[model samples]
Target: MDIPAALGGVSTALTIVKQLNDIDRRVDEAGFKLRIAEATSALAEAKLGLVDAQEDIRSKEAEISSLRSLLKRKEETVERSGYRYRCDANKNPIGTALCPVCMDEGRFVLTIQSDQSGRPYVCPKCKANFGYLSAFQDP
Candidate 1:
């Protein structure tokens, strides 16, 4: 459930608890039965709120895991010129140039393609062009 729904459930529980506290010392059997029913409903709502909170925690944990994995991949890449490239075991840059725009956004490192002139690299995913020395050129 969403945060607002969870909060609503908790709020309803608190309200019911306050009402139960305000009951008179000399209560009739029917009045006690009604209070018990209200308390049970409030408890159910509170349980739902707890379940929602647990689900939210699990979702956040999954997101954190994914971000950590992405960060690890980013750490393994090095930026050269205007593009990003994967590094070898020795930390040496390797493979084709990756889209710098995508890399900075924590997206996958899409390989930038070379045009006929080979003077600039173009990213197929974002269509962003990086003006740099051709990959075929000797540095």
Candidate 2:
């Protein structure tokens, strides 16, 4: 054909190819940005789950500490008077001759005998006297 017309057609073909290359590059960049957004969201959700697990562990530790304190109090009561209950055949408890004087010091000293009327119980271990306590004190 004519020389000028052939050069014009070649120029149009080169322009179309350049436009297609630009569109391909923009599409690849958009895909990469979308993947980055999704990964960021997943990481945030994982961090929230870790925080929840830590709170649960703290609450469990507090409950364990409270239970330990209650156990210590029960042990102290048992050491103060372990065998103070003397139940009869009808399950009625009779008072023991525990001296109140030594009990204040966390010692379980029993008086060997009492007066005839059961009052003024005397303890031979510490040489102390005490009145008769009720049977319903602590078992």
Candidate 3:
């Protein structure tokens, strides 16, 4: 379970194997039994590690599913708030329809013309017009 306990088990197994080897040097049947027992305990430890790895995989999958759902909820909220939404960049407005610059998505707006450039660009939020600078100056 804990590191210290795990290490302790390993130490015990090694000690048993070493004692069995000493007995083997003296040519006895009891040493063979000790070796078999130690090998069985090591196999059990390997099975426990396999189980822990499986649990870790399941935990990570659950976390991924939760994050996916959260992202979906946020995307729906943004759409409901009337932000211009477009997964693609090259979509042209239907008829004179345009997206509000505030929303930045190409939805729910009347068709509008670009500035003197005669291009087609609408604000994401209001879909009125998209411009970086006003044509008028106070100075």
TM-score of each: 0.70, 0.38, 0.37
Total clashing pairs for each candidate: 0, 0, 18
Candidate that scores best on TM-score: 1
Model 3 stretches with alpha carbons more than 4 Å out: 1-26, 79-139
Please provide, for model 2 over 14-132, each residue's C-alpha lDDT reduced to its tens digit, 9 standing for 90 to 100.
55444455555565877555544544554454455556656767887897886677455334332224434334445454455355566555555666546566565577778775554
Write the residue-wise lDDT of candidate 3 on 60-129 in tens digits.
8997897777555335432312332322223321233224442233233433445557665554446465
Output the number of the lDDT-best candidate. 1
CA RMSD per model (angstroms): 3.9, 23.9, 13.1
Candidate 3 lands at a TM-score of 0.37
Task: Specify the poorest-scoring 10-residue window by lDDT in model 3.
Answer: 130-139
The lDDT of model 3 is 0.50
Per-model lDDT: 0.71, 0.53, 0.50
By summed lDDT, which 10 consecutive residues of candidate 1 come out lowest? 130-139
Query: Which candidate order results from sorting by TM-score in descending order?
Result: 1, 2, 3
